[model samples]
Target: MKKSLFAPIFASALVLGLSACGATAETAEGDTATAVEAAQPAVYADLGGEPTGPVYRMAKADTLAVSGFDVVSYFTGDGVPVEGSEEFTVRYQGYDYRFASEDNAKAFIEDPAKYAPAYGGYCAWAIGANDALAPGDPNVYKIVDGTLYLNFSEDVATRWNKDIPGFIEKADVNYPTHTPDEHYQD
Candidate 1:
């Protein structure tokens, strides 16, 4: 697929602070842009799923409920709080969105798993092949050890379903060390 010329530089600026002053630009090669986009979490289809619940203050045993979709509620069993409470926003993947609060957003900053989409929230096919982040399906998710994870589109989820145990095995291997944010920008 042809990529936007400015996507890579833009993505790079997003993840790796472009300058000490924070000035950024978008002017990357098409291939570079494609590469950057390929490394990000899957894009969500705008379905406006039910609001699970608004972001709330982190409390003992309280996990940030999945805001947009009806997935698992907690981020971890240890009660490690996820999601920031302050009202701040960022462009995740390519979506212009806002978290309920900064605390909920900060939770993700501290530990992305607490807020990152499920199934690694990446493309299942790409994950299966260990290739790249595939666009995700918000509805397909899993809660492991209390942390929620999202997967790629349902089609990919269906493929993952074929070998549930195996897919999880690979995902487990990929999750901790292979964080998705290491790849993209806004």
Candidate 2:
């Protein structure tokens, strides 16, 4: 897998993911890190200003989710994600996701959870192995058991492949504990 050329830009746009990730880590003394350490994402849709914890990559109030990639494309055609269009956007749960075309957008609306990334688009390896939050690179990902899972980068993806099922098992338990209550579960 290749790293996203716009990783830095996407990181800036989705600082919420980093902030939520940073907030979940515990120090050796059992104290937790605060969201103050990093920029926070704006709370949107039903959050009512509450922190989103470990939801999807969208900046709570921002419209760009999944790095503006078409989630439907991840499951169709060449099975590679393509850039979605502003003209074909869909709001699922709370965040807005774009699609490459109207047909793709419709596909996503029919059943979002089927297309949504596992672990709320956070790094599956980090969540499973460390119970930690790390930015997921849309460019570097894998589909397992029909679920999309992203990693921090190509290097992280390599480490993730070593034990996909084991990490997923760990993440399955870890993710819901950190994610906000308002979001859907799978």
Candidate 3:
């Protein structure tokens, strides 16, 4: 009789242990699904602001995060813009450019969009799709709001074109807390 009673108790304990294990497995699977969703890249609807070739090249190239995009630009000794100017004294970082006359630079300055990059000169697709910040191709940019923007790469930009607004929303979600400035030296 004692043996029969002990067997039932042991069997009950085993059942409880197996149930606990199943619950733990379910919770783990749920957590993994959430992580995978977060990792997906943003797909674009309008392919306007993607990059092509390398926009700027220098010993020091960096990335920045702003409203979900990574903006890239090269700096001179005094932290001046160096990549997109025709004049010898034009600087890229400080947003200064020199022309034969001050008026010419001023005119360009007043409406830098005619010269600056699109989406604030950052990588539009990277920021838009997944709030990512990547180096931009100057050749793949357009001037919007008189500022420059950059892009991650040609491949990303191509995908970005499929859903521009959607990517922008996703990038906005990641921009505020993202690391890595676009123009850090070295």
Q: Which candidate's lDDT is highest?
A: 2
RMSD (Cα, Å) for all candidates, in order, is 14.2, 13.7, 22.4
Tens digit of lDDT per residue, candidate 2, span 77-182?
A: 9998899887777766556677888888787777877997887678899899998877788889999989999998999999999999999999998887885533
Which residue ranges in model 2 land beyond 4 Å of their true spot? 1-53, 58-61, 181-186
Per-residue error for 27 in candidate 1, Å, reads: 26
Clashes per candidate, residues 3 or more apart or on different chains: 25, 0, 36
TM of each candidate vs. truth: 0.39, 0.67, 0.39
Clashes of 2: 0
Q: What is the lDDT of residue 104 in candidate 3?
A: 39
Error of 3 at 56 (Å): 8.8
Candidate 3 Cα errors over 4 Å, as ranges: 1-104, 111-115, 118-120, 142-149, 176-186
Residue by residue across 135-156, what tens digits does model 1's lDDT show?
4444555555454545556766
Give me the runs in candidate 1 sitting further than 4 Å from their true place: 1-3, 7-87, 90-98, 106-112, 118-120, 129-132, 174-186
For all candidates in order, the CA lDDT equals: 0.43, 0.73, 0.42
